[model samples]
Target: MKVCYLISAVSSDNTGRGGHYESLKILAESIYENGLDVEIVSLGDIFPPTFGNTSVKVRFIQFKKSDSLIQYIKKVADEIYDISPNVIHSFDNKSYFFARLANVKIKCKLVLTKPGGPNPKLFFPRCNDLIVFSQENFAFFKSRSRYKDVNVHYLPNRAKKILCDDLRIREIKELYDISGKVILRIARICDSYKESFIQLINLVNGLNDQGFSCTAVIIGFIQDQHVYDEIIALDCKYLRVVTEERYTKNASALIDLCDYFLGTGRGVFEAALLNKLVFTTISSSRYPVIIDEDNIDELQHNNFSPRSILKNRTEASSKEFLSSVIQILSDEIKLNEKRKYILSVAKQRFDISSVMDSYMEIYLNCFPFKRNLIFDIILNSLVVLKVYALLKLSKNKKAKA
Candidate 1:
């Protein structure tokens, strides 16, 4: 069976860095390797080089600013019809919207993989199947009355073992002048993470003040220029921010070089697969929780994010969190044990091979193609208006601030 993967380059910037792109790349490559026909349909200017040397076909349908939404949808629908895929899987909400509307012309099974957190202003389109990465999201969707007839799959973000070249690792270390114990953070440098970035800098300073030689390296795409500038302006000798425009090396390679990983979402699993001690925190978290034998199950349930656990668990304060990390770093035996356990758990839970198998099953299962053109048009109109209003409100609030 042929599968066409839909990605929205406009929404994601086609930067080749975010979790959605990474996950799609891994899944698509695996599907192609399994001898099934796979094609990636990008609705923007150009696809990122994340595909690397893979032979999978990538078709770019550039959406011009002058084109109306309906025109773009028709254009995409024509392309998908030409590909004649049995299953069209979309990664982002925008792509899913287009695919849902386009499917009216071409009646094919549709799948949507919800990548980010829930949006209050947006509404999900009905599809043959839906996949969510976090357990909290999966449970919430599964219990929803609207999705009683939909097939909701709970699949966590996956990471495969990546082998980093020794030469490349040495070059990255020399370029960053990394020394002593390294705490690495990989995320998008946006307004949501501004407070977390500041907290991380302070934590590094505290670690050094406590007589531990430590350096913190942050590698990420710069989404908000103001936030990125604010983070860069902070005077911290122990901190280094590697913007995406500057660093082009594989992120997993950096994880392999780090002694501890500091961040949340898919990066937690990526770092764990590399045997790095993973510490997870949400955007609003004052302190991070270390993932070890005792808390791995709980954390994994929430996709290693403390957002769901904050209400029930009393988290450590800034000082207490730093002390805990320092204590772990100082004890070699404890740190080694934690690393081994994390690696084992990562292999068992996030192995890409198993994830691929699950996806294959979903793709092969036949699901009826159903659509209500009138209801869909009304639903899409309301969703677009709500999104527009939300954006306007956000801009007003930012201007007032």
Candidate 2:
């Protein structure tokens, strides 16, 4: 069966960055490998660097970010009409709404890949299936009355082993003149993940005070300008900021250059595959946990917290966290042993082929619809009319005032 994938933005550039784009790339590759027809549509620029001469049809449709819902529906509906896919899948709320609007006209099964915690407000009754990145998210969604019968599956975020070399790592290190220990953190710098970023800053500053040479390489798309500004204001010599597009093409190689890895979510999975020392701060967790074989399963199943943001971690916890990091960095033999175990776990669980198998099962199970054209038309028309009426009422009130 043919499938069309829709996302708000493919990447900071066409090649792509971030978990959503990476996840989409893997799933699309699986679809292609299985000999299924797949098409990708992005609201923003779409020439993904990762797709790299693949057969998937990737299209970019330009639209104003401020466009109204009706405008968005029309634009996405036009594209969906052309693709005529059996199933339309989306990755975010806006795209999910776009898929629903398009489905009204074409009767395609709508699937949402929920990468974070459940948002009841974004729930749509017409969605056929949902794939979540963590068990916590799956259970949360499953418990919702609105999603009582919806097919919700817990699929831990997966990352295929990435090839990287020490030579390339050194080249990057030399390029930046990072002479001391290289600590890397890849995440979207924003308020929601304030604890991680703040902790990274504090950890680096604290280490430097103890005469330890260390540099924190912060990478990822900047989601909030204020947060970005705060990071810049730190003016910590050990801090080096890099954009998502700069190293995403060879992300593993970049991670290889690091003496230690930080951040949470999919990057943690990638780091483990690369056998880097992974210490992460999740929203749900009180402090950073260094990933090891014993806790990897629980960490993978729970993933990162979606909504909670620690205002600030406690001083005692901060001191304990710093001690753990220093201890790890000081022990070369123990670090190597941990690396071997982490790599083995990654191979066993995060293989893309297995991830693809689960995805394929979901796709095959969702049958194509024999749509009631009249009912769809009536329902969608009523929705549009209700919105229009509300707008008109507000305009009349403004005019009278």
Candidate 3:
């Protein structure tokens, strides 16, 4: 069986935090082990030099963001035409949207997962199955994930266990000499939306003043060196920003090393998977402050989204948000109370052992025939399309009359 992953860029060069890479890493390893052919195709979004170091087999298709919707759709279809896989699993909105629009003529299965914030507008008319991370997210669009119409799987997003041997982790621990009650924000500096970085800074600073004495480690690709330099230039010595590369190895290690894990974008999912204590901030534009790329990325998902317009994420009461942050970090019992549920939920919903079984079941259902009966069905289906076309002509005439 040939299965392909359509995701954001998978450049062997990048060694940073990316949902596409992490999930696919686990999948490819499992699928390849099962003796199935696997390939991952990049959708040409994101900064260059993605982690190509993984064992997951990969390829890239140069898709431009500037292209018109029609052009983009055609290009997506064209790319799939060339890949010719029996099953395609697409990640995030753009890949998922365009893959459905491409809708190439093939007896293949299509499965999609929401990579970040759930944007309901991106849903296509038809796909074999859907996977969503949050039940709250699925509830917002219950019609789309009804389990009967589509094999909607409430498979919570999961990362393969971080290798623990990453070089950057070693580097961060040695370089920072990090110790005692550390809070972490490890996400892409260029995610589709943006914000919460500076509030996160202020929030952390506020907690420190409350006698919590916690340090925050910020990690992601600083696309601009001057901006990065300016962030480090801040008077708040507790807030530290590191390169995208170090964020994964070093920062994720720091998350493993730290007392509390702060959620920004999908990074919360990572921390949750690792059994770290995590908190996702309520969006509060109510307490206005300077929001930058990293913050905005977390808030807006940084501009890679098909629909980045998000007021719900940014418009939260910062003071209340700050209070919650302090309470969770300062109160051990309260923190663990939340952690017990999250860890329990993660193991139950995102566990990897049964994923391969799920995929195989979906494939068989979407394209049911493995023999020449499929050919007979196709011949009959073609005749049905022809008969439908003729019936459409008759219906149009009757309407005109």
Candidate 4:
């Protein structure tokens, strides 16, 4: 079985580092381990130019973003024709559209992993399979009249378990000079999650003022210059901001250095796996509290969607939420066993290895077959030229206008 991924560049201020690229790399490797072939067609210009480093041997095609939409679609289709992959999986809508066009004659299984939003536009009828991270998203898809027969899978995201020795964890702590209660919140310096970096600083400041010796470790890549500047301006002594390049690369190590997690989405799961008390500010029934057995299912089914959870509860302020966080952290001694229970659930559910079988089954059932290579090459070349001409004509029209 051969699968080709049509993904865009990881350069957007929002949703770029939301594990779209990282998860693809992990999934591709897992697929390869099951004795299938995998390839990638990365769209746009990925800055820092240092993504997708993996051991899985697959052909990597860099699709330049400078081209017009017609040109871009043509290039994708041409690559699909040349590769003749049995399955074309896309991570976003634009790529899915182009992949559908590319597979017009090819008739391959098209899969779409929905983008970061509640109401993602599901337009391609050719998409045989759809993957969503939450029940809410699944419900949204089901409500769409166009996809009554489409197969939509509500598969929650998974993460590799973080492994570190006690010595290593201690070293990380010492590097940051973290001696007191360590609180970690991992997110990009963006406004997508209704998260305020300024608010976090205030929370840390509040904790210190209340005679609690604690350090707030804010670790994430800086996507917005304005937000980054605002965070830096505060310079709260208790807040240690680690705005390093590719901070997600070192997320596990950083998670190990914290006593509590004060974030949403994947970071909360990672902290739970590491046996730390986790409190999410995201939308869910258990918002602003430690994730326990009683509320794990709701959060899990909801995919820990931060922004959505916060939207309904407009009355919930960060200052009010911080008080609950303070109360939880202050009573850490009494909640030690609850912390262990949270880790147990996280390990059982969120580990990538545990969930690989479902993915493997999906790939295996895609019904792989070969297409006429000679005819595809001939047709694709003609289509490419046609698109190029249309692109030129469009440009001319725009210039004349």
Clash tally, candidates in order: 0, 4, 31, 1
Those runs of model 1 whose alpha carbons end farther than 4 Å from true positions after fitting are 11-17, 49-55, 119-122, 165-168, 244-249, 306-312, 315-320, 381-401
* Candidate 2 per-residue lDDT over residues 168-210, each given as its tens digit: 5666676667776788887666676677887677778877776
After superposition, the stretches of candidate 2 with alpha carbons farther than 4 Å from their true spots are 10-17, 44-55, 64-72, 117-126, 163-172, 210-212, 244-253, 283-287, 306-321, 369-401
lDDT of 3 by residue, 1-401 (tens): 78778765423223234655566666666777777888877664342244355566777665442454356546767878777788878764445544544444654767777644554553233344766655545554455443335556665555444544445656765687665677776666553323445545776687776666877777776644555555666668777666645454334444675566656434554566677776445443322222222234333332122233345444445556567556765677877776776666545545565576876776556642223233433443343334334444545576789
Model 1 C-alpha lDDT per residue in residues 1-401, reported as the tens digit of each score: 89999986653233445677778877888899888899988775345556543568888887554455567667888898899888889887667776776776777788888875653235666666888888777887788777777798988888777665567556668988987788888777886566667767877888888778889888877878998888878879999888654354456556766788886767777788878888776546655667777667666666765353644566666667678787888999988988888888888888777777789889888484666546755776565444434444555576789
| Two-way TM-score contest, 1 vs 4, winner | 1
How far out, in Å, is residue 54 in model 3? 2.5
Query: How accurate locally is residue 60 in candidate 2, as Cα lDDT from 0 to 100?
Result: 70
Model 2, residue pairs in steric clash: 14-47, 14-48, 15-48, 15-49
lDDT of 4 by residue, 1-401 (tens): 78887775533322336556666766776777767888777654342222445655444444343466566667767878988888888876555656767777787877788743556442333245788777778888788866665678777777666664467456556666878777778777776643545545666787777666788877777777787787778778898777655454545556777777775656666778778888666443323456777667776656765653433234456556657556666776656867888778777877777877887677657532223234433443454444445545655676789
User: Which window of ten consecutive residues has the lowest lDDT sum in model 2?
Assistant: 9-18
Q: Which candidate is the best by TM-score?
A: 1
Selected candidate, larger lDDT, 2 vs 3: 2
Per-candidate TM-scores read 0.87, 0.78, 0.64, 0.77
Please give the CA lDDT of all the candidate structures: 0.73, 0.68, 0.56, 0.64
Q: Compute the lDDT of residue 25 as modeled in candidate 4.
A: 66
Candidate 4 segments whose C-alpha is farther than 4 A from its true place: 10-16, 47-50, 58-60, 65-68, 121-126, 164-177, 194-199, 246-253, 283-287, 308-333, 366-401
| Candidate whose lDDT is highest | 1
